[model samples]
Every structure is written in C-alpha cells, then in structure tokens.
Target: MTTSLVRIGLATALLLGSIGAAAAHAHLKASTPAAGTTISAAPAELRLGFSEGVNLKFTGVVVTGPAGVVATSTAAMAPGDDKTLVVPVAGPLAPGAYKVEWHALATDGHKTDGSYSFTLKP
Candidate 1:
C-alpha cells in the first residue's frame, strides 16, 4: 500500500511539472499602441511585451493599414529586455484601422502568434 501511494505521488508530481511548463509559453502581455486603442497620430514603432522571453530570429510583426501591407522592419528585442519586441514602421500611417500580426518563439521553444487592431484617428 505504501509503495502504491508513493508511485501515485510521483506520477502526480510529474503531471504538475508538465502542466507548469506548458503554461510558460510566451503570451502577449501588452503593447505600445495597445490593443484596440485609437491614436491621434501615427506611431513610429510597434512595441509588444510578452509573458516570456522571445527569440527575435523566429519572431516578426506584419502591419496592414488602409492601403494594405504597411512596410515594417524586422522585429528586434529591446536593448536589455528579451520580453519586448520592437518593430519599426517604415512610414507614416494613414488614418484608418491598422492590424498588427505578430509571431513569437519563446525561449523555451514554444511558438505563439496573435494579432490586434488599432484605429488611427484622422
């Protein structure tokens, strides 16, 4: 009986460990323009903050404006912050809805992607 209880406890511990690890994947925490925000002026860059550190080589952002496919530079991590992604917008954005599509590869090897839209007020 004792041996069976010990085995059960070990199994439960392993299961919990796996669950914790699975929850560690990078998740969008916040942004500069902020999700669903309406700004009076065009933002020079898009900033994304994640729950975990990300790998920029496998991470990127795609911006689409009224004209579609607004050019953006490759995403790079903040100078000393691995959890923040900085993407430079190539030019001024027009007054309209803009969508930012982002993909990130967490340091733990997990991949996550999400998109959000913000309106540019005229």
Candidate 2:
C-alpha cells in the first residue's frame, strides 16, 4: 500500500508540472508609456516586455489617439533583447488618451494579444 501511494503522488506531481508548463504562453508582462501613465511629452517609441521570448515577424502594436489611428513604424525586437518589442511613433503624439493594442507570437508557438491606454498631457 505504501509503494502504491508513493507512485500515485509522483505521478500527480509530474502531471501538475506538465500542466504548468503547458499553460506558459507569452503573456504581456509589462509595457512602456506603461498602462495608464500620464506623460507631459509624447514618447518617441513604445516598448513592451513579455513573459517569454517573442517572434518579431509575428509581433505588432497598433496605437490610436484622440484623433483616430496613430501611425506607427514597423515593429521590431529591442536591440539585444528577444522579449521586448519596440514600435516607433510615426510622428509626435498628440495630447489625449492613447490606446495601444498588441499581439505577440511567442517562441513556444503560442499567440497572445492585449491592449492598454495612456494619457498624454496637453
């Protein structure tokens, strides 16, 4: 009976570990002009940090301001970093509420996307 219980416990532990690993998708861990910030000057670029490494080809960000869609430069991985995505503002950001929507494909082949907002002071 003791040996049987030990096997069951080991198996349960292994199963739980695998489940945790399987749930590890690239989630948005952080961002620049960070969620809900109020800034005096428009940021030249936007930066996002993820929980895992991301594929630059499959990562993107769309920003919109009070006027409408704010154009952004092509998305790229931060220099020397695989977990940070950077998008440049095409021009000076106007004062207003800006929303940034992002999508990411992690190295693990999982895709995740999310959005946040920041207020630019006049």
Candidate 3:
C-alpha cells in the first residue's frame, strides 16, 4: 500500500508539472526605455516587446500627469512584428513625473496589466 501511494504521488506530480509548463502565459521579455527608466526628453513613441505575438488592439496604455490624462490615442498595433506593439506619443509631455498604465492581452488569451512612473528631468 505504501509503494502504491508513492507511485501515485509521483505520477500526479509529473502530470501537474507538465500542465504548468503548457499553461505558461505570454511574457513581456523587454521594452525599449525599460519599465522604470526615465528619459530627459519626451519619447517619440512608447515601445513594448512581448515573448509572443499578441493582439495589439487589446494592448493599451494611458499616461497621466499630475493634472490628468495626457494621451488620448487608442491602442495602436505595430506592423511586421506581431510580438511588438507601439503607441505614438505626439507633442511634448511636460517635464514632470508621469504615470503609465498599460494592459496587454496575449494570443494565448491571458490578460495582464501594469503601471510604471518615470521622471522627466529638466
């Protein structure tokens, strides 16, 4: 009975391990300027890279200043690379600390959201 229980436990462990690996969700491998990086000047665009292809329409970002939201552009999909999505940040974002909140839905159907703040040096 003890040996039988041990075998069942091992099998269950293996099954769970395989399922966990297969159920892994898409990840954000890297982003230009990085998530916590601060720039002296306003960036021309916001670039985010992912581990796998994602739906750009569902990938959205909102930049908010001390006053309120600064950008109104909807989520814009990047061409050529399905794993990358970019938002065009037009005009100049005044010098100050800004908060960027973003959400992305991977092709695997998992949704993730994150927020970061950066200071605009004078």
Candidate 4:
C-alpha cells in the first residue's frame, strides 16, 4: 500500500513539473526594419532581436529573393549575451520587396516564427 502511494505521488509531481516547464514564456520581442520597412538599398546583413535567449543551432533565415530562395553558407548564430543575431544575407537582392521568413527555438524549446519584407530600391 505504501509503495503504491509513493508511486502515485512521484507521478503526480512529474506531470506537474512537465506542465509548468512546457508553459514557459518565450517569444520574439522585436526586429530591425520593423517587419515591413523599405530600404533604399539592399542591406549587407539581416539582424533580429528576440525577447529571450534562443538556441542558434536550430534557427535559420529563409530569404525569398527576387526569383526564389537565395542560397546561404553560414548557419544562424545562437544567442549570446545579446538576444540579437546578425544573419548573413544570402546574396544581393533585386529591386523589390524581399520576404524573410525566420524561425527560432528559444532556450525553453518554444519555437517562434515571423516574416518581414524590405524593398531593394527599384
């Protein structure tokens, strides 16, 4: 009887602990260009600022250039002391609004997704 009671208590604690952890608050705070800012020229790089620290290894930026998705070599950098990252622009963007679709997983394992656009000056 005692062993069964102990097992129930342990299971209850584990379930509660998992629920609390999964409810962690983590989200993207802001971003440069404000999601729809038009630039006179193509920026050398793209940057993003988040509300919390994130795992850079699981993060990436997919830039849909004039034609299609631009190729990139560098992987997104993980969060450091600064909750911002400087994502490398795959290549020179054409004169038009380019879309940037980004996704990042916070330290708590919650994923955030967002998209932004910038004009390369026609």
Question: Which candidate leads the pack in lDDT?
Answer: 1
- In model 1, the runs with Cα more than 4 Å from the true position are 1-17
lDDT of 4 by residue, 33-120 (tens): 5576777866767777777776778776888867788665576544454467667766676777678788887787778788877667
Report the lDDT tens digits of candidate 3 across residue range 63-113.
887657876555566778887778777667788777778788878677877
Q: Provide the overall lDDT of each model, using Cα atoms, as 2-decimal numbers.
A: 0.91, 0.89, 0.74, 0.72
lDDT for position 120 in model 3: 72
Question: In model 1, what are the clashing residue pairs, if there are any?
Answer: none
Candidate that would win on TM-score: 1
RMSD to truth, every model? 3.4, 4.7, 5.3, 3.3
Q: With candidate 2 superimposed using the best TM-score fit, by how many Å does residue 34's alpha carbon deviate from the native? A: 0.8
Full ranking by lDDT: 1, 2, 3, 4
After the best TM-score superposition of candidate 2, give how far the Cα of residue 78 lies from its true spot, in angstroms. Answer: 0.9
After superposition, the stretches of candidate 2 with alpha carbons farther than 4 Å from their true spots are 1-23
The residue-level lDDT of candidate 4 at 96 comes to 75
TM-score of each: 0.84, 0.81, 0.72, 0.72
Candidate 1 lDDT tens digits, 1-122: 69999999999999987986788899999998999999998999999999999999998888898999998877689999999999998887889999989899999788999999999999
**Residue pairs with backbone atoms closer than 3 Å in model 4 (clashes):** 56-78
Per-residue CA lDDT of model 2 for 6-108, tens digit only, reads 9999999999878866876788888888898899988999999999898999989888899899988888898999999989898877799999989998887
The 10 consecutive residues of candidate 3 with the worst lDDT sum are 20-29
Better of 2 and 4 by lDDT: 2
lDDT of predicted model 2: 0.89
